[model samples]
Every structure is written in structure tokens, then in C-alpha cells.
Target chain A: MFDLQGYGPSLLAGASMTIAVGLSAMVMACILGLVGAWAKLSASYTARATAAVYTTVIRGTPELILLLLLYYGVPTLVQDLASLAGYEIILNFNPFLAGAVTLGLIYGAFATEVFRGAFEAIPRGQTEAAQALGMSRFRVAVHITLPQAMRIALPGLGNVWMILIKATALVSIIQLDEVMRKAKIAAGATHQPFTFYLLASFIFLGITLISSLVQRQLEKKAHRGVGQA
Target chain B: MNFTTMLEYLPQMLDGAWLSLQITGLSLFLGFLLAIPVSLMRLSHLAALRLPAQLYMFYFRGTPLLVQLFLIYYGSGQFRHELEQIGLWAFFRDAWFCAVFALTLNACAYTAEIFRGAILAVPKSDIQAGKAFGMSGLLLFRRIIFPKALRIALPSYGNEVIFLLQASSLVSIITLMDLTGVASRLVAKTFAVYEIYILTAAIYIAITYMLVVIFKLFERILNKHLRTDS
Candidate 1:
């Protein structure tokens, strides 16, 4: 009575949606993490303070709350801004978009710490060597600091990616039609909650398994030259 | 913009927050209890004990908690006669029991890993010293290994507590009137979804902030020996 043929398409669609959301959110988190690290490490006191507050507040709130708030609150916020600017505009919010942004913001706080630690691990001698080679400060950073820092940060970033993948499952609660939601619908329709749920968990396990393999490859590549030294 | 309106619904929200706190607390206690034995089993050299513990962690950690809750709460209904024969259908029928059971199982897996890591982290030198002092088994664990592992595990365990608190929001989906359930209900009744979500999120932020401060204090006291200036 378990009709995989009938539900196969929807379940696959859900898995792809989960991946799309997870990848988009990863890009957003990376951008936010970069900026957060910069602000935290900046010479300006206010920049440091602003980054501190951002990370602190984001860390203290649950991602579910953030997702719900953005999914519903974004349009209102846009409307208020438009009215204040003497224009009338309507904005439609998608749960996928809201979920990605919410997850991005929630995990960015953690990424900020990881990036900060990585950046701090970069030795002053390397930058000095880059400067001695007549490379400008910006060029040195682009050519030397970033590559090395990212290498150091790979393991931590991989851990975050795992967390992000699991966190994406929560998006289903907001009716995002991701894997978990897909599984729920199938369960309800077939009256086989255990079967559907177990299938969904297996799919997720497959994802995390493949992800761990890819992460191991990345870490090995990142550490290519270091083992000799 | 709807701050004043949200204020009008504050009492109900507060009650929901209290319920959330209770569920989180009770589940954490239950999970910690379950975690201790499972962690020991996981650390055991015996294959029989270790394989099942490994499977427990593998399934719980890999799956979504929402699905787990649904499977137990709704799926249990599918086996009403079987569960009734075992006298468990009565317990499984309640949303709170289902929520707590799912949360506790999930947390047990995570907390087991945390403790396993802490146990491994306990200095080998100290363990050897305990043996040298003529202590073994329970005496050694009680006098040395348990204390050190607990201290090592405290910070990560604190993060687990925060995670559990956040995860309890999922209970609302199962018909339990937690903070998120209240927010969702109010959103339905008044169509003030945005305002209610903001209020709910703010309450969570306050609770999380308090938890972090308390954990920091605990860490300070426990780690006094390592304090550079102390």
C-alpha cells in the first residue's frame, strides 16, 4: 500500500528545495560572516560595538522565531518604509526566501565567531612577507590572508553546514514544502506516518553522509601542503 | 507598529512562556537521565552495548525532531490496539507526553555524544593517578573521571540546553500551547502574525540571554582553578 510511484515526484522536489534553500542560505551566511568578522576586528569602536550587538541579539533568539517574524513581518516592514517615503508599494514574501534569510542570520552569528578565530590564527609574519613583496595591503589580504584563513576555517564551516542542513528541516513547519513537509503530506494522505517519517530521515541521512564525504575531501585539499611541514 | 496590540495579549503569551519553560526543563532532566546510561553504553567496549547506542545516536541525530514527534504522536494512533495491549496508548495519546518523549530521545542522543567527548577529554594522567592510588571502577569514576568530565562538558552542555529550549517550539505544532503555539493562535484570531511573532521572539531572546549568563557563572565557578588571575 506504500505508493512510492505516486509520491516520488513530490518527495524529490522537496529534497531539491531543501538543498536550494540550504545553499542560498550558506551564501548569505558567508557574506554576513565576512562583514561581521570585519566589523568585529575593525579599528573603529562603534564598528566593533555594532557587530557585537548584532551577533549577541541574533544568537539569543531562536531561528524559528526569526523565520516566522520575517515571513510575516517583512511585508509590513516594507509597507511602512514605503509609506514613510511617500509611496505606496506592496511586497510579497515567499516562505523559502524568508526561511533562507532567517537561517542565514541565525547561523551568521556562529560563523562570525569561526571566521574571527580563523582570522586571528593568521600569523603577522605572512602579511609582512606579502608587504615586503611590494603587494598593497588590500592585495596582500586578497592574495594571502583570505586563502589561509579559509583553509583554517574549513572544519568549523563544515560543522556549520551540517547544522544548516538539519536546520532547513525546520522550514517545513512554516509550510515550505521541503523534505519534512513533503514527508508529512505523504504520511497524512497514506495514513503511514512512521513509514514516511522514516523515509524522510533516511533521505536526510544520505545527505549528511554525502556531505561528510565532500567535507573530508575539502579539508584534505585545504591541508594539501601542510602535512609535509 | 502593533506593539500596543501585542501588549494586550501579554497575559496569554506569558502563560505560554511558562508552559514552554516547564516542558524544556522536564525534557532536559529526562534527557540528561537517559543520556548518562546511553553514554556509558556508547563508551563500553562490549559490542552488544555499543552498537545499539550508536544506532540511537545515528537515527536521532540524523532525523528531524518534527518528524520524530509526528511519528510518535500520530503514528501511535495507527497501532492503538497494540499499544493498548502494552498499556502505552494512554501515555502516547497526550500531546505533552509525545512532545516530551521526542524531545528527551533527541536530546539523549546529543547529550550522549557530549558526555562521550567529555569522558574522552578527561586527562589520562589523572585516571592513571587514580589507579595508582588504589582506586578502580565506580570509585575511580566517582572520585576522578565523572567530576572532570562534568566540568569539561558544562559549556557544550549549556549550548545543548539552549538548543532544547529552541526546539521545544516545535511542540506547538503538535497542539501543545507553548509560546509558539500561543503566537500562532493569536496570529490566527487577530491576523496580527507579525506582531505576535516579534513578541514571541523577544521573549525567547530574553530567556536565552538569561541562560547564557547563568552558564557563564557556572563555568566561572567550576573552572576557577584555570583562572589566570585567580
Candidate 2:
């Protein structure tokens, strides 16, 4: 029966920021994943090697290390580059931006695997037939490969989104005013840790449930005609 | 950039590495032990046992482990009087104990699911054979089902072990001087954030690489029939 009256507004505001951060990171992760998968699947040996190493290195390391390095080092990295270019300017890294980019970068590794599997799932014959029909490579990819890959990758991407949402909790360590951070602040101030945290947990649970529902609907839509077949 | 500063702090980083390994080792061991019973409960026909296991797994897997750590570490302070009444306040007071507690709970949830999946993967025909050979209940489980399940579970469980290693990094947030904690302290002292992180990441890569090698060899030996020359 612990009332959230006093701190409810801030918690909601924090949840909003959490969603924004999660979405922004999800977008970046999708972009990185697509590019990584493309490189890994491409004809160039160097491109494939670079993509393989990036995914391997990122997947093996913990996300916290990456977050801390980016948070504390990005500013220095910028300052150093600026000085080298003859401008000695001071720089500050935005916590939200840092959090999103880091999460995107980390999960990009997993997503590459997902997309790679999706790409592999598409039979080569489909592309061959498309090419036999005099379709351009762009047309073949867009019309035949991309849609089916999206259908197959959607479930995996949904899983990545789940992990991404949970990862937003880590950004609180960098002092981003996301839901976890706000809950921590309120818990410390009120000495009602369970109340705030439990509520925050429920909020996270609600988001997860909704996202799962959305994922289900998307899956149904993606498989509309194929499932009947 | 400052190699000397990093080299000077290498000892602290190593100390942190020891603590990290100890925590991950201890927690995953306890968690693995807990996982067996919890997963069995999840597989139970009785709603009473099954429901609790389901809810526990759902909550733990659904939420982030970091918040779980925060709740156990900081949340317990709010109930000191109750904990003191139960004579458990002393345990909750230590950050190390809280970190281990939270990590074990989170790991148990994941490992339990892995166990459950492996249990389901056990061929029913094999169990029927066990029963036909005059085995039943606990005897059947100990002789046949458990062994097969463990074998089936090994690869995924190896991934879980590596994940537990990664998750152990969060203990640094609870004020425990595990690897990440010590590295952060060094960063504060020397302002050599990038170098220290790169060095620490290298150690993690080394550990994870070693684990992958170990697991691959173990799996090969465990499932001799499944091995193929690549």
C-alpha cells in the first residue's frame, strides 16, 4: 500500500526517457546489425574479417566495461582529437546518448548473429530464380530477400529488444535519469526501497508484456499468408 | 596512453580479477545447485510447487539483474529492525554477501530454465526403458534421466556460465571491489580510463576464450558420438 503520490510524476518522466533511450538504441542496433550482417555475408575477405572480429570482441566483453569506457573516455577522446586538430576544446558526453550508443553497439553483435541466421535461412534458389527473371540485385534484395528476412528476424529482434530494455537499467550507473536511476533516487530519499523498486519492476514488467504482445502481432502479420500455406 | 600508470596498477587489477573469479565461481556453483531443485519444481505437476518456480523465474528473468542487486543491497537496509529480529541483519549488511545473494538468485532463474529445457529434451522412450528395467521415481532419475539431461544441457549451460561471468561485473556497483570496481578506482586515481579498460577487457577476453576452449573440449569428450572432424 505504499503510495507513489509524491514521486509518481518523476518516475513516469523517467520511464518516458527510458523508452526514448531504448528506441534510439534499438534503431542504432538494427542499423549496426544490418551493416554487420551485410559485411559478414559480403564477397570481400577484409570486410568479412572486420565484421567477424567486431562481433566476436563485443560479444565476449561485458557491457559495463564498454559503458564506463565510453562515458569517461569519449570526452577525452574528443578533446584529444580536437587538440590534435589545433582546437583545445572541452567536451562533455551526454549520458543518454552514451547509454544508447553503447547498448546499440553491444547488442549489435547479437543482432548480427540473428540477421546472419535469417539470411542463411533464405534458400539460395529464391535469389537464383529472382536473378533468372532478369531482376536487378537491388530489386531482388528488396522484394525477395529483405521481406522474408524481416519475417524470420522479427522474433530474434524482439528478444534483442527485451535485452535492450533491461539494459537501460545499467545506464543509471552513469547517472542517466532513466527509470532505474529515478527509482534509486526516490528510494534513497524516502527510505522505501522496496516500494520504489517494486513499482519500477512492475513498470518494466508492463513494458515487457506490451512489447511481447506487439511482437506476437507483428509475427502474425509477418507470417500472414505463409502460415496458412 | 600512460603505460607506466597502468603497469603500476596491474597488481590491483589482478587482485580485482581474483575477487571477480571467486565471486563468479562461488555464486554460479551455488546457483547451479539451486537450479536443479528449482527446475524440478518447475516441472512438477503440483500447482503449488510449480507456480512459485514459474513466478520466480518470470520475475528474475524479466527484470534487469542490476536492479535486483540494488533492491537486495539497499532495500534490506529499510528493514533492519525486522532482519535484526530474525538475526540476519548482519548478513545483509555486507555488500559482498548481498552481491552474491542477488547474483545467485538471478543465475538460478536462468540456469533453472536451461535445466528445464534439457529435462524436456530427454527422450521419453529412454525413460520408458528405464521404468521397464525395474526403475522408477528417484531411482530412475538418478540412473538415467539426470545423466542424459546434464549431457543435453552442457552446451547451453556453458553459455550460462560465461554469462554469469559477465553478470558478475555488476557487483562492482554495490561497492564490492571486483575487477570492474578496482578498475574504476584506478581510473579515478590515474585518469587512465581507456588504458585500464582496454587492459581489463583483454583479461576478460582471455578468460572467455579459455572458457570456450574448455567447454568445447569437454563437450567433445562428453558426447563422443556427436564429434565430427571439421
Candidate 3:
């Protein structure tokens, strides 16, 4: 057995931090995704245009750059605005919050596309029928649109989750105590970069492997009684 | 807001942009070339070939590229004596080599999967047609399979190339002066963090847009014969 030099506990802690950051970011991404999908589907020109621009700009740029901008740039911007108002203020974004929010913003653009596609794939007739039956728009969304769209969006959302988890590794650049950062510390201390990085990769591979299995189960449950005899 | 500072940094940023393109272009070309054989191995009937191919894809596709880069770059230092004895330490010592090496390995895994899917999607009827015409082996592949699979894989391959381009930014972490690296350095010197990064983001966006446009044009050219215009 390879010697971890008692760094095993810290690595485990770091792995949990990675998962926590990823889940929190997933929550943020899901909220933005829903609002984005709503905006894209809305009748107003401004809402649609704003959502379009958001997805386009975010999707076109690199995630690391966005993370860096949020980490380094935002604080300066906040301070500059404060100074312009003749009130001095220092703003240092918590690294954990910055990492989660940056990942959320980057992945939310992708989730928006997934949700929009899922929403559009729902047949128009069902919504119209619900409306005709005196169901409110909210009621129609809840009873008709949401369920079917969830079934379709599940696969894409699963994909977003996978990518988002991997992107959490980038948070290590901001000095977050995620698995990658912890592994780097262990590697440096042990002079065993290969061993530690290899283990880190395995941790990520393990997450994806488990997530995919759970996703399959979710997809099956979502499709229950519909595609089978 | 500081137009003067941004203007001064523009040349350095553009130089970094060129280097980024170089790394991306070199890796994509090599990776794609390697992927053909890897994809073929993945599709092979033999368990030996397919098993290794599957593991390679799983490892590369499952892990984050940053880890892979670190493993290749810093990890090699752990075996410096072995590497030096083998006369390969020089290559591993160079950050540029490690960056490209890792990126190419990653690109190969992803591009192989794309090719595998595209190859699978090539119509069975078309392959059968080639067989009926006495085509076999390389002849069949060149005349029938390659062209069709290229068309099918073009879109995903384009996305892969963009991913590689974006992934190339990671090289900056290893101390290479790619676009992101130069931007970070500029930020450190000028303290104009937002201005430098926003400008960098704009450059990345432009390159992404250009790649998309190029891929779309390529797709149009590939499908031109399928057009039914009178």
C-alpha cells in the first residue's frame, strides 16, 4: 500500500469540499437555468434578447477566465464603485462563494440551452388543451409542461452536473481547499506528484462513474410507464 | 475604463493569442491523427484492443484536464532519475512539451469517441454497397467510410477543437505565456484586473465565434452535393 503520510484525512475532507461546492453551484445553475429558459420563452423582446446575450457570451468564453474575473476583477470593480460614491469599502469575495458562483454562471448558460430545448420539445397541443380547460398558466406549467420537460431535461442536466463537477477543479486556482488543491499540497510535501494527482483523477472518475449510474436510474424513473409495455 | 493601459497591453495579449493558437493547432492535429487508430481500436472486435481503448477513453474523459496536465508536467519530476537515464528528461522538463503532451492525450480520447460515434453512424447500406462493388479494406474505408464519417463527425469535432482551444488556457497555470497567462501577468503589473480580463474574454469570444463560423462553412461544403436546389 502507498503511504499517504497521514494526509489521507485531509484529502478526504477536500473531496467532500469539492462535492459541496459542486452541489451548491448546481443549485445556483438550476435556478439561473429556469429563469433563463423562462426569459427565452417569454413574449417580451427585452427578456428574450437579454437571455440570448447571456448564454452567447458565457458559452463563448472559457470557464477559467470567468472564474478568474470573478475572483480578481469583481473586488476591484466593487471598490472602484464605492470610491466613486465617496464611501470607501473593501470587498473580498469569499473564495468558496466566488468559486461556486463562477461555476454556476458558466454552466448556467449551458443549462439554459438544455432547458429551453426540453421546454420547446413539449407539444404545443398539451399546453393549449390545459389552457382551454380553464387551467391557469401556472397550473398548466405545473401539471403539463414541467413534468414532460423534466423527463427531457434530465439527461442534459445530468451532463451539466458532470461538467460542473469537473470545473470545480479550477477552483483550486483561487486557493480553495478542494481535492485538487489538497492533492497538490500532499504531492508537494511528499514529492510524489504522480501518486497524488493520479489519486485525484481517480476521485473525479469515481464521481462521474457514480453520477452516471444515478442518472441512468433517474432517467428510467422519469420514463416509467411511458416507453415500456 | 483605462484605455491607455489596455492599448499598451494589446500587443502582448495578441502575442499570447498567437501562442495559444499554436498550442491548440498542434495538439488538435496530432490528437486527431492519433484518434483515428484509437477509434479503430475501440471499434475492434478483439478484447485486448477494445479493453485498452476503453480504459484510455475512460481515464481521459473522466478526469479533469488540469489534473492530467499536472500529472504529466509535475508528476514526471517524481521519476526524474528514471527519465534522465532514459534520456527523455529533457523533454519532460520543458513545460511546453508537457502541456502539449497532456492536451494531445486528452484531445485524442475525446476525438476518438466522436469518431467512434460517427463511424458507427455511417450507413450499413453504404458499407454493403461498397462490399458489393468489390471494395474492401483501405479501399472501402477511403471511398465510403472516411468521407461519410467525416461529415457526421464534423460538428462534434469542431466542438472538440474549441474545447481544446479553451483547455489550452490551462497551460498558463504551468507558467506558459499563453493568452490567459499574459492577461494574468498584465493584471499583476497594472492592477487593471477587470480591463485586462474583459479584453482577454473578448479575444477568446472572437476566436470561438470564428471557429464556429469556419465549422459551419465546412459543413456546408461537405453537404453541398446533398442540396436539392433547382
**Better candidate by TM-score, 1 or 2:** 2
Chain B only, TM-score of each candidate: 0.98, 0.96, 0.98
Prediction 1: B-chain TM-score: 0.98
Cα deviation at B45, candidate 3, in Å, is 0.8
Q: In model 1, what is the error at residue B107, expressed in angstroms?
A: 1.1
Query: lDDT tens string, model 3, B133-209?
Result: 99999899889998999999999999999888998999999999999999999999999999899999999999999
Local error of candidate 2 at B209, Å?
1.3
lDDT for each of the candidates? 0.88, 0.91, 0.94
- DockQ each: 0.65, 0.72, 0.89
lDDT (tens digit, per residue) of candidate 3 on A1-229 = 2688988899889999999999999999988998999999999999999999999899888888999999999999988888889989888989899999999998889999999999999999999999999999999999999899989999999999998999999999999999999999999999999989998999999999999999999999999977761
Interface RMSD of 3: 0.6
> Can you write out model 1's per-residue Cα lDDT over A153-201, one digit (the tens) per residue?
8888888888888889989977899998998898788877777777788
Off by over 4 Å in 3: none
How well does chain A score by TM in each candidate? 0.92, 0.95, 0.98
Candidate 3 local Cα displacement, residue B177, angstroms: 0.2
**Candidate 2 residue-wise lDDT at B215:** 95
Best by DockQ: 3
Question: How far out, in Å, is residue B114 in model 1?
Answer: 0.8
Model 2, position B195: C-alpha lDDT score: 84
lDDT of 1 at B63: 72
Clashes of 2: 0
